[model samples]
Target: MRVFIRIFPLLATLTASFCVQAESLSARLADPLATEAMLPLRSASALAARVGERPCASELPASPLTPLDAVDLALCNHPQTREVWASARLQAAQVGVARSGWLPSLDGRAGVTRNFTDDSQLTQRNAALSLSWLLFDSGQRSANIDNARQLLDAALATRDATVQSLFLAALQTYYRAQATQAAVQAASDAERSARESLAAAELRYQVGIATPADRLQAQTAASQARLNTQRAEGDARNALGALANALGFPAQTPLQLAALPAVAAANEFQQDVDALIAAAQVRRPDLKAAEAQLRAADASIAVARAQGRPTLSLAAGPNWQRFEGETTRTGSIGLTLNVPIFTGFENTYRVRSAEAQLEARAAQRDRLRNQVALDVWQAYQSLTTATQTVQTSRDLLASAEQSERVALGRYKAGVGTVLDLLSAQSALASARVQRIQAELDWNIYRATLAQAMGALDYSLLQAAEGRP
Candidate 1:
């Protein structure tokens, strides 16, 4: 009775506090939008301020942005990166949950009972506190902990891989946007050259030096060049939109990109394929994640095997009871040994299943290693081809320029046919497009090789920005 008196006020106080909190929660739930559901939309200026404060947000000196700036923006703003980061955090919490198996647990219970028999009523009240600790579980606890730790490692690696993938995507899109902008300029130049040829042809026809057919052909070429310019401009706009999307911005956001530099010397990327393959094996995050998963699968096998073994535990409890006005206080301490005798061969089948999963994981790891090596090799070859194409395209552009100039000079001197001049002009236009595409392809393939080797990062973007 004395003990009950001492605890009664505390219980009543706790119950009152809980009731108040529950009522408050109920009110909030009834009008959830007022408290939680209705979030205020951030203004553009607020969003800009928030983005400006982030370390990864680009600090642009002007409207145009460098490749490094674009990559920084993507890293900061992209949802894919944030999603993977959140997943890693969740896996870390799961690791904590697994490790808690090593600690003891406590629980409290309370009950009341009422009975009526032979016109007499009996009432009972019971309260108890219990503690349980698993002293040993063969090796199940350790195995589970190991499994969780390995899974955490895998999640972290996967996050890194996702970041690298986003970087690669941003780089490719940036390059495409830059290339398309250059194409627009090239098309404008073509239009100017076509107009000049048309003017020359018109003067020649006025002076009876060229036929009407020549003037019509020149007109056709100029119109075609104008059309090409329009098409190139549209492509540039589309590419810019894609780049914005890659940076996790609205597709309609205006973005100005810095011009790409000329290709570097051929010796810049000279390396043995075997060396690259070895580097990929060391640096590829996806491969590392696969290895970690295999380790986790191996740990799971240990956990399954331990299920058939014995577990040692300790339990303790204290109780207070009142039945029909009689009171009793009781306490107990016990050590329990649990051994698995038979569960219809469940444990055996579980062990076998775990072993099978381990084999599958090992096979997957092996396959990923092979795939990584193959990717490195393929990227290396493509880079080599792209490098060679860059040189060839530059040479072709120079030759076409010289030929066009000579053809124009011959036509003005009244020695060359209009057909010859038109052919030269067409060749020049094609060569310009080819050179731009070749350069773009060379840069993209280089970035792809870096991605395959798991070396794509802001440093690579900086290096690309510094290229001549």
Candidate 2:
């Protein structure tokens, strides 16, 4: 009865402890945010079921979506973003595993035996509990924990970097779609002008004031304008498909994007190149991840060096046995010290390998730093060039509009040739296309610069969209 009471309490305690540990580990592994992020990518129906709402697309307002909305959708639904989050969670669990090394481990055993002899029979029952713990291991335990923690930090930074990159991609795609839509409008206007010229030529020919060649030329221009309009519409549809893909939706998903905002003044990005580079170095998540990896490598070297030294551990065993109506109890506690004298140069090689890894990580970090600076410089220059192009294209568009107006007026007054009117109309169409392209380029470059600086986010999209 006493043995049963004693074993029951121990078993109960062990079971309770195991349940608590299991619950804690489960909580650590469960990530609601990542699960939510993955839901949209998996199926709209599933997301609707989970949230008790309609699909995301159906719930969107009827009004055209802004770039910020697109970026938000991408962040929520993109597999790439979810992948990073999952990786970070895995790394966090690894940190937990490393921490567990500090705690003692216990094992329980039970056995029953029966013996038969010529004149005797015997039954035996045994139970034992054993525990082993590392009392000291140089600094290897601490070093392992630190290495795991640094790796987790790197994983977190990598997730942020992925988010920034995906946001930039979605933003760029949104602007491209807007630009193509503008091109369709411009092509429609050109088609209208061409039709008007064709009408005038037909009327003049019927009145015997226009030659057959003039009528034929006007007809050709009208046909070309119609073709151009159709082509522009096709391009617009394709751009929308691309935008949908960027937003982590199926390519054919319909998206109504708001018109692109006007280009901002050059002064908005007038910070010195050196200052921009410094900001990028400080803010870039990829660079931070690299630095974290370097720290982990350094910690690994410490672990390897510690492995070559001595270790101290503690152990305990408590056992009970019942045989033929007799009972016995045994318990023991001991300390052990182990020194690594030699292992065919295994420790030496481990230290050497760890050092090499540390060197490689240091080199990689330096390379990343230089690459980050270059990214900032390149994005900055592109933004500057795009800003200038926006200005020049606006001027050209204004000139072309004026020229087309004058040519149309002169044509109506019988002072301008059909060729001159057609040329002016074509120039106006080209100017419109150029202006749209330039504006989109400016916005895309701005977003790229922010991404390169690790500052791309929904807020940046809001600011860019809010600009005139």
The model with the greatest TM-score is: 2
Clash pairs detected, candidate 1: none
Please provide, for model 2 over 360-387, each residue's C-alpha lDDT reduced to its tens digit, 9 standing for 90 to 100: 9999999999999999999999989998
TM-score of 1: 0.86
TM-score of each: 0.86, 0.87
Residue 245 in candidate 2, Cα distance off native in Å? 3.0
Candidate models: Cα lDDT each: 0.84, 0.83
What's the number of clashes in each of the models?
0, 0
lDDT for model 2 comes to 0.83
Please give the distance, in angstroms, between residue 129's alpha carbon in candidate 2 and its true position after superposition.
0.5
lDDT of 1 at 130: 98
